[model samples]
Target: MTAMMDREAFEAALRQIGAERYHHLHPFQQMLQNGQLSREQVQAWALNRYYYQSQIPVKDSHILARLQTTELRREWRQRIIDHDGQEASEGQPAQRGGIEKWIALTDGVGLDRAYVESGAGILPGTRFAVDAYVHFVQEKTLLEAIASSLTELFSPNVIGTRVRGMLEHYDFISRETLAYFDKRPVQAKRDSDFALEYCLENARRPEEQEAVLNALRFKCHVLWAQLDALCFAYVAPGLTPADAWQPGTAEKENPRS
Candidate 1:
């Protein structure tokens, strides 16, 4: 049997997975961050990505259910709250959540909110990828589930580049439209730090560590696959699926326009 790696080495292995396989390196992502895509392309991206964003809390809920301790559950519950937001009550205003903020992003891009939320127009690939992730969280070991979230480790840099490039190059894009990203880097950092610590501490055996590493890799594939779907459907030959969202088909008034 292989010997287990030290905590530091295990952590380094996890980060290496992000360095090599994260979707930030995907071609579609590069085009996006570099402002190479057209408005329709960006709209497609936002519309499809809304599916993924909406699922964040669903996967987190699966993870929350499996957590054995109150402290762990408390920490995990915040993720759901962050994505789903709090309801308005007796004395407080309703705070917006990540999912709502994402809707605003799609709205900013001129997609009808009802259509975006309906998931009727999303690509088959997007639905499959996002659903696979939720199933992964539900079926995998808790250690693997937490390790999968380590993709957050690389997201801050991607968010920074995407926000800057979109604002500079896209006439249709505004900082307010991109508001979802403003809060994600901080939230991702906090969440990734906790997940990394959990995986490093709990994955004691060599096989367990391997499972943790593979979990991150699986997540990286999930993200990369989403981009691959986008690239196929929107870029190059642009063979959009028969029923998927077609640009200029079901759009709202561009607030920026």
Candidate 2:
């Protein structure tokens, strides 16, 4: 069996996972931040990323269902509403539902709404990694599932970097087009803070602490792999999956312009 880690060491390991494997370091993200991607490349990114955004509530619900404590479930359930929104009659839709805003991003990019929702054109890696995350939450011990979500602890910084970089680099992108990220940093902090406190208080042993740290690492890989797949498939050209989106399937020309 693996050796156990204390609280300090466990926290350090989680931070190290963010440092080493987060998508911020990926070359695709660097290209995006530096204004190197073409308009088509950005569109491809938005369309594929919609899949990830749509899956968040499903994963959160799975985690919530697994929580035995009423207090824990109550804490976890808000993340679902944050992403899915609890609109009654849906006049304008809720102000902060992440899913509706993600669709708006795809619309801004000029992708066909149906194409994005069908998920037929998403990369195999994106599907595999995202599904794996949901599965991990459903199948693993509830403690580990909550611990895996600690990726949100690092998300706010990434969201800031992405928003600023997207605006600075892409003249075609406006603040409005990128609105999906505006609320995420705050939401991520709120969700992750709750998850971190839950894990820290519940994981009483050195072994459990180590498992929690590893779970964070696994979640980091899950996020990183999605971007890496995008980089390899869309950025490089001719490397895209057989079923993934093409250069002009939804529309011809740079839709952003």
Candidate 3:
């Protein structure tokens, strides 16, 4: 049987996971901040990352569906609204949601929405890692699923750094283009706070605590690997996957072609 754990120690373990594995350490992110990538590489990144952006609310909704309390559901539902928008009134086009805003980012970077949404340009590692996250949430214990979200514990600072660095270094990217991030720090805070509390409260055994911490570590790896693949394929001379998106080429217009 798994040993029981104290809450404080478990919390410490989760923080340690963040300290070691978060994508803030990724060389690609560093190069990006340092102005090393070409315009095309940056465009490819924004295009591929649209898949991750689109997946966020789906993951949140799956996690939200498992929470039993009305109050908890209330807390979690805001995440959906943040990504999907409130809905259309009778007259106006449906208010633009986070996904739409993300499309704006891709458009700003010169990627076609069809190509980005098709996910043709995304790294294989990105697809695998993101799929792992969704599967983890659906298959793991609720406490562990919540724990996986604790990556946001470390996200605000990184997001701040990214926004400032991208704005200062990249001439092609503008504040309006990066608006998707503007509300993320705040949203990440609210969501992570709730998830952290859930994990700390429910992870009552040493083994259980460790499991949750490891879940967070797994999620960190998921984020880190995406950047690693991007660096290898886009920044370095080679390593692009066979099926990966090649910038500057349009998708074939004919269905059979």
Candidate 4:
């Protein structure tokens, strides 16, 4: 059995995994933040990324159902609300949610709302990656499921970089279009702090500790694989997979050049 590292050591080691393997390191991301991708490539990114964002609540809901404590569920349910928004009354305006914000981003990029919502146009890799995350939460042990969310620890930095880069470079991307990200840094910090503390407290055995680490590593793979598919199909070889979204296929006509 692996000797258990001290709590500080364990936390530092997990942070190292994010530092080394997170998708922010991927070439696709570099091109994205560096302002090197074409409008079409940027369109592909926004369209595909929506699939991931939309699944977040589904995955969180799965984990939420399995939590045993009222306090835990209270904490977890906010994540679902953050993405899905609160229940609205008839004739009242809806509370803006992350999913709606993501739709705004796709629209700003000239994608048809119907096409993006239907998700028929996204890459195969996107569906597979997002679906796998939902399944992992449903199937894994409670501790492991919570540990997977540790990806949130690294997200603020990535979100900061993405928002800044896109605003500076893409004419179509703006503070308004990227409003989905504006609140996420605070949300992510709160979520990751809770998740990390949960893992450190619950994972008493060395093997369980390893499971927590591996869970975070698997999440990093899920994120990195999505980008790998995007880079392969959209950026380099320039071959979008069969049945995936093609530029200008939006239900509404794209007004951009």
Best by TM-score: 1
Sort by TM-score, top down from the best:
1, 4, 2, 3
- Which pairs clash inside model 1? none
Give the per-residue lDDT digits (tens) of candidate 2, residues 82-197. 88876656566545578888987887878888788889989899999999999999988888999998888877887877788888988778888888888888888998888887
Q: Find the 10 residues in a row with the least total lDDT in model 3.
A: 248-257
Can you give the lDDT of residue 156 in candidate 2? 88
Q: Candidate 3: TM-score?
A: 0.90
- Judging by lDDT, tell me the better candidate of 2 and 3: 2
Instruction: Indicate the TM-score of model 2.
Output: 0.91
Candidates 1 and 3: which is better by lDDT? Answer: 1
lDDT of 2 at 37: 86
Model 1 agreement with the true structure over 60-134: per-residue lDDT tens digits: 999999999999999999999999989999999998899999999999989999999999999999999999999
Across 173-200, the per-residue lDDT of candidate 3 in tens digits comes to 8898899888889988988888898888
- RMSD of each candidate relative to the true structure: 1.4, 2.6, 4.1, 2.1
Judged by whole-model lDDT over C-alpha atoms, candidate 2 comes out at: 0.83
- Alpha-carbon deviation at 48 in model 4, angstroms: 0.9
How many clashes does each candidate structure show, in the order listed? Answer: 0, 0, 5, 0
* Candidate 4 clashing pairs, residues 3+ apart or interchain: none
Clashes of 1: 0
Cα lDDT, all candidates: 0.92, 0.83, 0.82, 0.90
TM-score of structure candidate 1:
0.96
Per-model TM against the reference: 0.96, 0.91, 0.90, 0.95
Candidate 4 — which residues are off by over 4 angstroms?
Answer: 87-94, 254-257
lDDT of 4 by residue, 1-257 (tens): 89988899899989999999999999999899889988888888989999999999999999999998999999999999899876678987677889999998888888888888988888999899989999999998999999999999999989989889988998877788889998999999999999999999999989998999999999999999999989888887878888998765673585552
